[model samples]
Target: MKLRTFPQGVFLPHHKEDTAHLAIVRVPPPSRVVLPLSQHTGAPLKPLVQKGDTVKRGQKIADVDAFVAAPLHAPVSGKVAGIEDWAHPTLGRFQAIVIENDGSSEEFRYDPLPEDIESLEPESLRLFVREGGFVGLGGAAFPTHVKLSPPPDKPIDAFILNGAECEPYLTCDHRVMLERAEDMLLGLRIMVRACGAQRAYIGIEDNKKDCITHLTPLVRDLPFPTEVIPLKTKYPQGSEKHLILAILSREVPPGGLPLDVGVVVNNVQTAAALGRMAKEGIPLVERVITLSGDCLKKRGNFEVPLGMLLEDLVALCDGFTTPPRKVVMGGPMTGITQATLAVPVIKGTSGFLFFAQNVGKPEHSCIRCGRCVLHCPMRLLPYLLGRLAEEHLFEEAETNRVLDCVECGSCAYVCPAGIALVHLIKLAKFEVMRRRKRGGK
Candidate 1:
């Protein structure tokens, strides 16, 4: 089969060879874990527990009054030291509940799973998801229940499973598909049932041929229509808009969501988590994260707790051989740089990349070579956006559709001038949003 190609995407070094074939290991529990209240996309969850209170594993410690949010749960049996402001890797400083492990390993009681899930109503299933503290594991961290509960006017016709692990050096989804094929299928079925969608499609990048081979036969029998479409191995192909376009040939309009086009996309890992929660009555405490980069002696995927620190993960991966200049939470392209090793891995963390020392010099000036424009997937002029943002013409940048930019870093990757186009676009988007919030008088 011929591979389909997309416009304005770059092919950079993957650097996944170090841990591509390594089996995933389980990291031991840390003595202390910091649970942030603002891990998801909506308002910060209100703390439900107070200092000196004891919490067991799977207990709900924080919750919100809003519908577009998920409650926070205790990952381990511990005592609440206090609520304090901690360094959040992505959101800067935020209030977090610090829990000191008491070494009890006590498990909290959960409601018994019904005899048959299919017999339950869709609303019941959605309630279960919300109570389980489920969120978009693919990185967005949007509440899963809210995503399932689309407005009545906008009906969902298709449920797309994002198996396209196109992010460089991130193989957590790849391993999930290969190992938990049945779980992925079951999760898709749950989603299909909940959304009342007609069909489901799993899109995998052509690079993961082994994953495709493993998932093909898993969905052969019973139930709904499920097919695996091999997408062209390109940067940002795993993005929601790009994946929808690549698989279904449907273009999500600028500044529009997949839901706008009658589609709801979920990550393969998120689907698997959903399946486990619905079937086995489990909450999301542990998730698979890829730990790799140049400075480590060992590199591989590990199923670590939600609040595990980067320092502990490094130790589990056999410690750093050389000092790492930069430590990112996700893939290098979109991941946030960690200020210190004490940063905990939140729900959206997929990969921990460690770059070697003395990598390269600082970025240089833009020479107007037009490489960024040539490689932008959104077809927006990144150079123009960057220039306008630099000149502080926020409205001009918005008129040029700067807010629609996905910030996938493709423009930065292809810039011969070493211009930081993604950063500039981000700044412009922030300003536009801020002005709109102030009523834009």
Candidate 2:
């Protein structure tokens, strides 16, 4: 059977052998959790709970008035120890709310909504999603309520649930697909109703045929027509733009969102989380994450409370088999490397990768093999962007559309010269955005 795919993406070793088959284990919560204020994209939240205040699990502890932001919830019932600077997984250091577990296992439950959530008014559903702190769980962590609220001019026609699990060594979504298929479907239905989509689709990589088989029959339960699309196994296939292209034959214009094309896309885990929230009367306080790499003693997927530190997670795996040369949050393709494990798990974190040795190579001059350009899913001129960045010509890079680069690292992965094309392009993109923010052309 032919599998759907986007053009110009490179295939890589899946590297999911160690944890793909493992069931998600619930990790014990640490005595204290360090909740970062700016875990999601948009405005950073300010503490709602002051130091020494007692809070319950699933209680809203931090929030901001901005429409683009999601509130932070207490993952475990605890007393607010302090709010201070702490190591962040992406940011070097950020303000965090430290909570000391009170050992009561208390919870703050919202009034239960009807099980038939899709029957509610769309506006009501959006408000509930915002209150629940729902965000894209596949890694971007953009507020889900905002995504569901496209302008009237951009009416949403379809909803796509991403289950590609395209990044190497990340199988949290894959496991979620197999184990929580019903919950995912429930969430998908709610989203479709909220977005007033005519139909919904779930896209899974063909490499995981079991997931395709498992979900194909289940989608029949949804009110709107929903199909399980098997995407070709390729790196970055899970990218929102690429997934839309592969499944719907739609190309999102450069810097355009899925909504720009009358479609809304969300991760499978995000949908599942929403389903869980509706069913359990809980807020977003935990997530499933994959832990795997060469240096780890044990590896598998885990259901972890938010704000648990990476150091505590590593210890649960029985510590490293060997001292890690590098530790990365999320996947290797676009994940950030961490200098310390003091960082706590934030909403956007998908997994942690620990490598025994440096996976990087010394930079070399661009060999002009055209491989980076040939394989870039975005179809941008990465080599040209890299050179422009090296020359500190941010404006030139911007003119050439460097901001369109998704930083999937396909250029670096396929580069014969190891030119660090993604890094250079990222720098150029950052500079361009910084300049634009400062009102510079």
Best by TM-score: 2
lDDT, candidate 2, 1-441, per-residue tens = 669999998999989989988998988888999999998889999999999999999999999999999998999998999999999998889999999998898999887668877679999989989999989998899999999999999999999999998999999999999999888888888898899899998999987898999999989877889999999999889999999999899988888889999999999998998888888878899999999999999999999999999999998999988999999999988889999989999999999999999876776788788998899999898999999999999998999999888889998899887788888998999999999999967
Question: How many Å off is the CA of 134 in candidate 1?
Answer: 1.4
Q: What does each candidate score in C-alpha RMSD?
A: 1.7, 1.0
lDDT of 1 by residue, 263-375 (tens): 98988988887777666666877788898888888888888878887887787777888899888888888888889988788888897888886344467787888888888
- Pairs that collide in candidate 1 are none
Clashes of each: 0, 0
> What value of lDDT does candidate 2 attain over all alpha carbons?
0.91
> Per-candidate TM vs. native?
0.96, 0.98
| Candidate 1: stretches off by over 4 Å | 2-5, 112-117, 358-364
Candidate 1, residue 280: how far the Cα is off, in Å: 2.4
